[model samples]
Target: MRRLTAPLPRCALVLGLLLTPVGCAEPEKDKVTIMVPWSGTEFKAFYAVVKDFERDHDIDIEPQVTRALTQQLDAAVAADAEPDLAVLPSVGAIAKYRQAGALSKLDVDTHAYVQPLRGLGMNGKDVYAVPVKADIKSLVWYDARLTARPPGSWSTLRDRSDHWCLGLESGPTSGWPGADWIADILLADEGVGPYTAWASGEGRWDKGPVKAAWTEWGDLVAGARKGAATFNFRAATEKMAKAGCSLSHGALSAMAFDSAQVKTDGYTYVPSSRGALQVSADFVGKFTGNRSADEFIKYLASPRAQRTWVNEPGFALSADNRVTAYDNATQGRIAAMLRSSRYTLCFSAADAMDPDVSAAFYRAVLNYTDGKDLTPLLVALTRVQRELGYTHPGSPPPPGPLCSPPNHP
Candidate 1:
C-alpha cells in the first residue's frame, strides 16, 4: 500500500506519491495533483482558493507550482506519468497533447467565455483547458516626474535621449521582449492582417514590414543607449523608477508600478497606430479525468472563484463576463481595453507559434541585439516559418453556439 507523506498544511508541498487515501472503510475521495506555472505569491493565492474548495468538498488537491511547466509536463508525458492536470502554455500545446491522448476532454459549461478565449485549447468539438489568468502586454511605463505625459509617438520619445530604460539580458528564453516590441510596432503600423499572417507562419520574417519594425525598434534602442543593452529585466523596473528614466516598456508587477506612472489609454493614435492585448494564462487542463479535478474546474469557472481572483494583487480579471469589477482602477482600465471590440485582441505570436520555430525566432532577436545584422536573422527565421505553417488551415470553429444565451453573459 502507498503511504501518505505530507500533512494538509497550507505550505507543505509534497512531490510524489499516490496521495489518494487507501485501505479506507467506506471510500477514499479522489486525490488529484495540479501543476501550474505560478509560484510564490501566485501560488499562495491559488492555494487559498484550493483550500476553500477543499473545505467545502470531498476532494484532495496537491498543487505543484513550477516555472518549468512545459519541461515537466513533457517529461511526465514521456514517462507515461503525466499529472492529473496542468496549466499548459497555450492552446496550441493543448491541441498537440489532446492528439497524443495525454489529456481528457473537459466537460464544463464554457458559455461564459468569449470567442477568443474559447478558440485556443479547443478543437471542433472538444474543450481542453479553463482560462485562469490573462494580461495586457506592450505597456510603456514612464516616470510621472520625467515625462509630462505618455508620448504620442515613438518619435516624440526618441527626440529626448538618455531618457529610456532598456534591458536584453540573455537567458534560456531571451529576446522575447524584443519580439514583443517588434510585433506591437508591426501591429500598429501594418494592422492585424499582416501580424496574424506572420504569427501563423504564412508570412515571411525577411519581408519589408518585418524588417522595418526591427529597424524602428533598433532606432529606439540606439537613441537611449546608456548601459541599457545589458540591464537584465530583473529589478530593472524598480531601478528605472529610482533612477527616474523617462520611458520604459514591458510587464511590471505591482511593486514596480508603485513608483511608475499610471494612466488610462487616453493617448491619441495616428492612422497607422495599433495595439495588441494577449489574454493568456496557466490554463488548467484535467488530463486524468479525475472527478475531483472536474469539480475544481467547475468551481474555478464560477463567479465566486472569479471574484476572488480579481481581488488578488498583481492579477487581471478572469475572462468570464460575470467578473466585471476589479480591485482597483488599473485592472479595471486594462479589462475595459481587452473587452472593447474597437481594439484588436491579438494573442502572443510567440505563444501561438510552434515551439521550435518560436525558439528560433527568439534566439535570432537575441543575437540581433549584439550588433548582429537583422537581415540574416530575418532570412533564417523566415525559412523556418514557411516550413511550419499555421496550427489550423483557417480560423477555428465558431464558438457562437456556446456563447449564445447572450443575456446570461
Candidate 2:
C-alpha cells in the first residue's frame, strides 16, 4: 500500500502558484538588429557602445557584420528581411534606399553636426539617416623624420610619389583610396564649385577638372609599388615604416598604426592645403519601425555615445560638435576640423554618385592604377552616369548639399 500524503492548504497552494518558476525567470529583452560592415578593431569599438546601451536599457542589440554590406543589404531588402537598422557607407546608398522606401524617417537630433553631415540623409523635411562615424579624407599623414614639412600644395606632393605609401586594394571597395586621392586633389586644385558640380552628376567627367584630376592622381601613383593594385590598404599603411615611405594620404583611421605610434614624435599629419577637406561618414538608417531600433539609433547619435565611440581603440571620429573631447590631442584636433565651419567639407565624390556609377568609378580607378588609359575610362564612366540619371526625369535633385561651406544651410 502507498503511503498517504497530506493535502496542501489553500494558502500554500496560492503561494506556490504566485511563486512559479516561469515567472521567476528574467523577461525576454527587445532585440534590435543592426547590419554593419565593420570588423576587427572597428567592430570592437562599435560593440563597446552597444554593450553600454544594453546595460542601460532592457534591450538586446544583434549586429550582423558583412564586408560586402551593399550587396548583402540589397539582397536583404529584396527578400523583405532587412535588419532593424543598417550602417550605410555611402550617401548614394542612403538615397537609393530612401527613394525605394526601404528606410524609415529618423527622429534623432542632428543640430550638433555641421552642414552636409546634418543633411546627408534628408529628403525635404524627413530625416532618413544620421552619420555615426566620420573620416577626414583630406589629411595627409607623414613621418616627420623623413619629411621636414608636409607639402605646401598638391603639385609638390604629386612629384614625390616615390616617398608615398599608396594602396588601392580593399576587397570589394579596393579602389576607394585611389578615388579619395582623386577627389581631394580635384577639390583642392579647382575649389568647391567644380567639385560640387561633378559630384552632383551635373558636370562632365570626360572633360575639364574631372579629367585633369584623374590624370594628376595617375601621375602621383605611377611609381607606387608593383603590387599596390592588390595590396590591402591597411597592410600597405602598416608597412609604411618597412617600405621606407614617409607619407601616407588618407584618413587617420585608415593608417592602421597603433595609438601609441600616433602619439609619438615621428607620426604626424597635416590638413590638406586650401581648406577643402574630403570627408565621409558611415550613416545609420532605420529599416523597420521598431521602437527599440529607433532608441538604439538615437542613442548612437547622442553626444555621449559619440564620445565613447571616438575614444575607443579604433580611433573613430564624430561629426557631432557636442562630442568635443577625444582620446588624444591628434584625434581632438581632427574632430575640431570636422566641426569647424571655416573649412569647406566636401562629401566623397564617388560616395555621392549613384551606386552603379560609384562602382564603375572604383573599377576605373583600379584600371587606371594598372596603367590603363584614362580618356576612354572617363568616357565610359560618363556613359554610366548618363544612363542612370541621378533622379527620375523632371524630379528635384536628391536632398542635401554635396559640399558644405562656411555657414551653409
**Candidate number of the best TM-score:** 2
lDDT tens digits by residue: candidate 1, 49-149: 88878889889988777666777888888997878888876655665677677878888776676546655656665777777766555566655455566
Give the TM-score of each candidate: 0.80, 0.93
Displacement of residue 72 (Cα, Å) in model 2 is 0.6
Residue-level lDDT of model 2, residues 1-409, one tens digit each, is 2333444466688889988977789998999999999988899999999999999999999999999999999999999999999999888888888878899998987877876877887787678899999888888887666666777578887756346787888888888888888999999999999998888888888999999998887777667747788877887778766655767888853448767768764677887756778888899999998999999999999998998999988878898877888867787887788767679888888888877788999899888888788899999988888877474363335547888762466
For model 1, state the Cα shift of residue 146 in Å. 3.1
> Where does candidate 2 stray beyond 4 Å?
1-19, 252-254, 391-396
Using alpha carbons, what is the TM-score of model 1?
A: 0.80
Error of 2 at 122 (Å): 1.4
Candidate 1 yields a Cα-based lDDT of 0.64
